[model samples]
Target: MAELVRVAALTGYFPTMQGLGADPRPMLRECGLSPELLANPEQLISARATMRLLERSAEVTGCTTLGLRMSEERALANLGVASLLIAHQPTLRLALQALTEFRNRINSTLALQIETFGEEIVLREHFALSSPEPHRQSSDLALGVLARFCAAVLGDGWTPLSVCFAHERPSPSEMAVYRRLFRCTIEFDSEFNGLVIAEADLDRSAARADSALASHARELISSVMSPAMRTASQEVEQMIMLLLPSGRATIQYCAESMGSTVRTLQRMLDADGTSFSDLLNRARMQLSSQYLANPRTRITDVAGMLGYGSIGAYTRWHSQMFGISPRQWRASAARRQPQSSAF
Candidate 1:
């Protein structure tokens, strides 16, 4: 089963209906999706489904620049938490870090890796678990998003130093749009997928990077990242930190919700030198300490939230794991906080 990618949720950024042509329903239908689903702001579709639709639209419309068209519709808020980090960071380095770290919160299958050279920054795309065809389409979509992001960030003055693709040579018209959008040299059939931008240009400072704007942008992006990466393992762990109140936490339900088969998912996790069990235990331990320290949630409710069938089960597990009872742990945590003045 394919996981819902929540592309429609992203319409907060790219909600243009024009140039989409009459009866866009056929395009959604071709992609194995419903046209009605596109109207729902809260709806999500599978990455594979969206890619298939994009490819079909490209072929049907004879427009290889369809990716670019979609990206051009993006509103800055749609980039989510990424927008906040990008807006406030003192330098491009921090901005890229926030992006790389939180990318799964925006799009799970798409990974952005940034390498800084003498005067240029290389942004590479690593697509997750995709077939060759969708992989290519993913790269195209990634490039389009990056181009649009940079354009928005830099405003009218911004242009990529150069653009490169891994696909076959683009046609004259496609190349023209690429050039027009990027306003710089566009190269196709390159070794990797990324944009080359001068370091100096990235630091030039945008007109919209004020502190107030950065703060509001941060809040908006954080909300977007939370939902978008809800199905993402790392982000899910982050969510579990807040969701978990006590005891043992499991990854089974999380994996199922993300639409991943257990064994195959475990294999991919192993490739990352980790396991689902490890992540679950780590999350449990981290959240247990935090919840125990907080006075707001009751002990029983905390245990229940952690999926414990009974208080006894949670207490036993806590004692075995940390050699301390839950009450003792909470007492210790309370002692660490500053005391309130009764006078």
Candidate 2:
């Protein structure tokens, strides 16, 4: 349960493969996936496997836009029960909040956070970090699916103010497709990957919502949800992911958020066969790779994101964990990126 997404997360892969003129069966087999597996939306699969599949598909097909293609074909109903809960919420904000709250049931590894910046709301959808390389396919598919969901709830005319990606910018030809799809400005090399929605749009009533059905859906989902499937350490790690960017990923903060004292939290983690420091180390190691993958993220910023007070301290920790300076590691990753003709 490191991070699990639904096998059906690859729902669009078959069609996308057909479009790319590439046979997916071989690739699927290579990735340990198949059409039958993806047919079941509730079947849990490794998030890492999904990421690797997309990346490998892109690599093999010479189509760096593999994820975008999949996203473009994504249907809102593919979300299964979560779709029922989301479809009945009164407003887009409520629908999104419901999805975020219940996402663990669908994909325990994905993180969705909404940040309001004055009149704009940023919807951040985070997937698991699978490699040191830029996760273009992952980024595009995530944003594309988000766009589809926004359109689903806000009516066909709804569009975001901007769509952002942390990966390098696509070619002008590819950029044209993004512009057409998003119907707005697209930012590449962004610090984060997500949708930028107008604050006004979030409160707008969704056309398909049914309050009664929504309540029923909520009850159904909760009835079957095993909230404690995640260990104490896992819960704390997820909490840390949310709090780290805000400079609040401390043990005290996590304990307080969980409605427990620091000592009790420590005892609970100990009982679960992990320690608070071990959890923090694991989270930092995971997040550091993700943070460094974004070239726009400064080394100092990455340090701060990982909760280090100074660049020096972060560099020391990074060197210790990675066995190379952060700069050197990043440079190596850049050199290994696959070349595209569009480039």
RMSD vs true structure, all candidates: 19.4, 2.7
Global CA lDDT computed for model 2? 0.78
Give me the displacement of residue 20 in model 2, in angstroms. Answer: 1.8
lDDT score, residue 313, model 2? 89
Across 57-142, the per-residue lDDT of candidate 1 in tens digits comes to 66666666667666665665676546666756554555555665665556655556565789998776544432222434445657
**How high is each candidate's TM-score?**
0.60, 0.88
After superposing candidate 1, which stretches have Cα over 4 Å from the reference? 1-3, 8-22, 80-85, 130-135, 216-232, 235-343
**lDDT (Cα, 0-100) at 162 in candidate 2:** 93
Tell me, by lDDT, which candidate is best. 2
